[model samples]
Structure formats: structure tokens, C-alpha cells
Target: MPTAAFTTLGCKVNQYETQKILESFEAQGFEIVPFDSPADVYVVNTCSVTQSAEAKSRQTIRRAARQNPNAIVVMTGCYAQFTLRRGETLAEAHLVVPNPDKLRTVEYVLEHFPHLKAQLEQARQRGETPVRRRSRAVLKIQDGCNIYCSFCSIPYTRPVMRSVPYQDVLEEARAMVADGYREIVLTGVLIGDYGAATGSGGPDLAELCAMLTAIEGLERLRISSIEPTQVTDHLIELTATNPKMCPHFHIPLQSGDSRVLKAMNRPYDQAFYLELIQRIRARIPNCAISTDIMVGFPGEDEAAFQNTCKVVEQVEFCRAHLFRYSPRPDTPAEAMRDQVPEPVKSERIQQLQQVAKAAARRYAARFIGTTERVLVESRSKLSGLMTGTSDHYLQVEFAASPSLAGQLVHVRITDLTPDGVLGELVALQ
Candidate 1:
């Protein structure tokens, strides 16, 4: 059988798409091999989110080339889709399938390599078994981001909002449940804007949640991320009532200062964001609310930085993904005046990170002694311990056999650490 390996970069949507492609390959009698191993084909699912991400994609492609010079090196994803301007050429691949329909990519492989036809036929006759995914399954219900934030290159790379048909999403969810995936994280670039592009308008995210809740045996359903403005009353109410929905929300709060927000082309302000948080907390008291905070955007000064810190102190996010705003080429914010000094950006990022860590520690401390439902992810590489994430998304570590992986178990948070929560397995129930 022809051997194939894949390297996926970027968001959960890209990862989920890679999995589907892998399944298609397996169905066509392709022996899935480790990415480092020599293979007949090497697929690099690229990301162009940041300049660094694009660099990593190139590095991975080079590594694949080194592993097997003769192997078909296929590249796809955001980077491949927008490589024309970047001047990147997939010269390594015998057949370059740039951003092809994922399922069609599989068929293209089979057609190109006619020698695998017999093997594919036999595999098809036997039918492919549902592959079990580790810990969390990222179900890509939607794709593309419509909102073009000034600092973002994602909209340029992955323009247009396209949601998978409602029925197709349901079918994927059911398949994931059957494959023993306890947690399904619905992922997309702009997931909140799901049904706007499609004329169906039949099912918004709230309705999608309702349909997902009906799927039996699915223990947890989580949204990867959503904008504050998109968090509708119906969505909040549904999350409050749905037992399957995880009690965690990661909303991006780029800046607290209204001036910075306007410069960044962000729709909402500090007041709007704080009210949204209040509403969420009112509905679900123990919800673990997290956010993305970008420090050192163009023109930010001491006052603006202080305003962010004040907001952080007041709003008290469970955790914050602190980022130093690096100027991406061709972004609107990249050309803006009063660009923050590299030294200043670095200093502010460190300060914000410390604050974020303090907040996370405090949030995790609150869960101590509480028996929260955790889905076991993997054995820790550091100490050979079992680790999992609580329903509220706290990383909890405990002693357990490898057999515990992928099982939903209740673990009582015993101690809080800066990195993760130390826990004791209370019961499997």
C-alpha cells in the first residue's frame, strides 16, 4: 500500500480538515505513516496566520522534502490558498493541489496514482471504520472569517464566511460521538458569523447548539472562540440550559481603550465588553471566561497600556492570551503611524503575561476540592502523569493508567499550580 503522512499547522479548522483528509487516504488503502518517516506522499496543511506561522510552514515543507525527496509533497490550507502574492511555489509536489475541496483532494491523489486503484477498490468494498480521535475532537462547522479586523490577515487569506450545511454538521457530530469522542469543539475562523453568508439562514449558532445537544452520548460540546458582539441572548440562554455545552467562553477582547479599539477597527469598546461579561456571569456564575488581549498596537502609549491593565483588573478574565501586536505585511494597522517600539511591545507583553498568569492561578484555585468532570487527554511527557481538561477548561493532572485516556472522569481539584491544576481522580462517573 502507498504510505502517506501529514503535517497540519494553524487553527482547529485546519486540523479538523487534515483529519478528514487522513480518513479519506486510509479509505483508499494509504498506510498512514509518521510525518518524519519516509512515505509515498507528504501532505503539509499550512497556516499563514502570522509571518512566523508561514515560516514554520515553509520549514515543515523543507523537512518533508528531506525525509523523502521523491515523495509527492502536497501543500494546502491558508498559505497555499494565498501563495500567489507571497511568491511561494510548491515545486516539491508532483501534483500541487492548492486549496482543493478536501474530499476532492483525496480523490485526486487516487486518480493521479493509478497503481493504487485495486487497493482503493478493495478498501472501499470493506468500508472504512470510524477512526477514534484523541481527547478533543475539533468539528469544523464553519469556515472563513468575514469580519476583517484591521490588524488581521486571515480575511485576506480565507475570505468569505461559509458554513457547512446544518445537516452535514449534525452528521459529523454523530460520527464523532460514535467514534468515542467525549468532547466536540466547534471551530471556525469566525464561527459566530456562521449562517450569515448562506441564504438558508435556517440555523444560527444557537439553533446549531440545540441540534448538537440532541445528539446522544456526546458528553461535551464547546465553542473554540467567538467575538463579544456575536454572543447573542439566545446563544447565552442556550449555553446556560444545555448540559452538553462546556462552561467556558473564550471571547477576544483586543483592547479595553476605545481609541485603541477604533484604531484597530474593532467594533466594541470596554464598556460593551464588560457588560457582555456581566450578562454571561449572571446567566452562568461559574463560567470560565477567557480572552485574547493584544498589547502594543500602533500608537498605544503609557496611558493606553494603563487603561488595558485597569480593564484586566476590573473584568478579571479567567485567562488571557497576551500577544505583542506584530505588524503583518499588507495589514491596515501595519502602515499606521506611531508604531510601538519593539522594546516597549516586549516589555508590555511580559507585564500582561504576568497579570494573565495571576488571574489564571486565582481562577484555578477557586476549583480546588470541587469534583469537576474532566476528559482525560494524554499522559504527561514531563512526569508520566495523566492529564485532562475540566468542563470549565482547567488543565488537571493526576496519576492514571494510559487506559484512562479519552475517558470522562470526575477529578477533585486538590492543588493549584501556575501551569496546571493538580487533581485526584474521585470517580469515573
Candidate 2:
């Protein structure tokens, strides 16, 4: 059988799309292989959220080409579309599928190499077995963002807003649960805007989540990064009340400084953000809050950066993705004055990382004596122990039977590791 390797860059939406694309290939009789391994075909679901991301995307494509000189190298996703928009091309990519046409990559592959159809015929003649993948799966229910954040290019790349139809989402949820997936994480560029434009008679994000949690055998549901402003009181209540809801919210806090937030076109300011976090924590005991914090942007000075640090100290996010701001072409911030120096950006990132680390450690320490419900996904590579994520989003590792993988279990937190918490298996749930 023909072999294909895949890799994804950027957001949860991209990761979810890549998984769907991978399944499409597997359906066509291609054997999936690790990205670093040589294969007859390679697909790179690229990212262009930042210059570094695009550079990495290009490097990944080149690496795929090097892995198998004669292999078909495909590039799709944001960077592929962005590159063409700039009238540039990646000579390394044998096939460049547009971001909107990403899921059709397998069709493009079969169209390019008609002989692959014949290869599939032979593979089917031999026989096959379907394999259930990861215990937790990501299901993208919405797409596109209209926020037009000053520092983002996503709006330009993925301007079309549409929600996956109501029946389709629930049907997919049932299918995933039937496939043995214990949890479903909903992802989108603007997930909270799920049912607003769709007049599909579908439920809004909160309602959709409630419906998903009702699926038989589905143990957990998680909502990927949502804008702070879009989070509603009703949604908070649903998240807190639902036993199946994973007590975790990945709300993006791009910047903590009000001035910076305003310049970034973020709807909420420092006070509003603090109040939102406070409300969620107050309502849901020990709920995990993770965020994204951009370190430098045009006109962000020492005071603005200090305010961001103060917010981090206050929120004490269980996890924070720290990144330096990179100006996107045609975005408003690109033309703004007073761009911070690269050295300053680098310096601040180091400082904020230390602060974020200590804050996360403090948060993890709060649950040291408590038992957490963990969905055993896989074994930890570093510790060679069974590992999975807790309901509260803690990465907990413990010793258990490998056969117990994909089941929910209770783990008593013994201590905090550098990455997450080390635990002992208490009971299977």
C-alpha cells in the first residue's frame, strides 16, 4: 500500500482539519506514517499566523521533499493560500491546495496520480482493518473570523463565515463516540459565533455543547480557544453545571494592557478580562483557565508590558502560550508606529515565561492533594508512564495497565512534575 506522512501547524482548527484529511487518505487505502519517516506521499497542513510560522511551514515542506526525493509533497492551509495571495510559490510543494479546499487534498492527489486509484484497487484486494485513533478527537463546528484583529491575517485568509449544519455536527458526534472516542473538543476560528449566521435551525455553541454532552458513551466535551468577549453568562453556567463539560476554558488573552488590547482591536480591556476570569472561577471551583498572550506589538512600551505581567500574576493561568508579535502584511498593526525592537521583544518573552511558569506551578500545586478524573490517552515519553489529561486540563501521569488506555480513571496527585503532575491510579471511573 502507498504510505503518507502528515504534520499540522497553528490552531486547533488546523489540527482538527488535518485529522479529517488524514482519515480521508486512510479511507483511500494509504498507510499513514510518521511525518519524519520516508513515505510515498507527504502532506503539510501549514500555518502563516506569523512570519516564523510561515518559515517553519516552508521548512516542513522542504523536509518532506528531502525525506523522499520522488514522493508527492502537498502543501495546504493558511500559508499556502497566503503565499499565492502574495504572488509567491513554494517550489517544494508538488501540489498546493487552497485553504478552503484543504479537505479535498486527497482528491487532488488521486487526480494528479491516476495510478494511485489502481494501487488502491490492489490494496483492497489484499484486505484491510479499520483502526480507532486517539481517545480524544477534535471536531470543528465553525469557521472564519470577522473580528479582524489588527495583528491577525486569519480574517483575510479565511473570510467566509459558516457553521457546520446542526444535524451534521450531532451525527458526527455520535459517529465519533461509536468509534470509541471518549472526548470531543470543538474547534473553530470563531467558535462562539457558531449558530449566529447559520439560520440552519441549529443550536448556538452553548446549546450545541449541551447536545453533544448528551451523546451516549461520550465522556467529555471541551471548547477550544474562544474570545473573552464572546463568552456569555449562560455558557459559563452550562460549562459549570454539565458533568460532561471538561471544566476548562481556553480563552485567548492576547494582551493584558487595555491600551494594547484596544490597539489589537480586542473587544475587552484589562478590567473586563479580570472580571470574566473571576466570574468563571467563582462559579466553577478549581476550573482551569489557559490563554494566549502576545508579548510585543506596535507602541507597547515598558508600562504596557508591566500591566500584562500584572494580569498574568493575577489570573495565574494554568497554561499560557507566549509568542512575540509579528506584523502581518496589510494588517493595521503593520503600518502602526513605534514597533518594539526585536531584542526588547525577546527580552520580555523570557521575563514573562518565568512569571507564567511560576503562576502555572502555583495553580497545579493547588490540586496536589486532590484526586482528578483523567482520560487516559497515551503513555508519557519522558517518564515512560501512562499519561492523560485530567478533566480540569491537567496533564497527569501515572502507572497503569496499557489496556486501560482510552478509559476514564481517578488519579490522586502526588506531586507536580515540570510539565504537569505525577499521580497514582486510585480507581477506574
lDDT for model 2 comes to: 0.89
> Candidate 1, residues 1-429: lDDT per residue as tens digits?
567888798777788888788877876667777687898888888877666577788888888988888787777777777685566576664555667665467777767877667755666677744333356777887777767799998788788678888888889889888877788899888889877456314799888988888899888999988999999999889889888888888899988888999898888988999999899989988788888888889989989998888788766677787777878879999899999998998898888888778767877888888899999977777767898888888988998887888899989889986587999888995
Candidate 1 residue spans exceeding 4 A from truth: 1-8, 25-44, 55-76, 80-97, 101-134, 156-159
Worst 10 residues of 2 by lDDT: 128-137
Clashes, model 2? 0
* Residue pairs in candidate 2 whose N, alpha carbon or C atoms collide under 3 angstroms: none
Report clashes for each candidate as comma-separated counts. Answer: 0, 0
Model 1 gets an lDDT of: 0.81
Runs in model 2 lying further than 4 Å from the true structure: 1-3, 33-41, 62-73, 84-95, 110-123, 128-130, 157-161, 200-202
Clashing residue pairs, backbone N/CA/C < 3 A, model 1: none
TM-score of every candidate relative to the true structure: 0.81, 0.89
lDDT score at residue 75, model 1, on the 0-100 scale: 78
Superposition TM-score, candidate 2 onto the true structure: 0.89
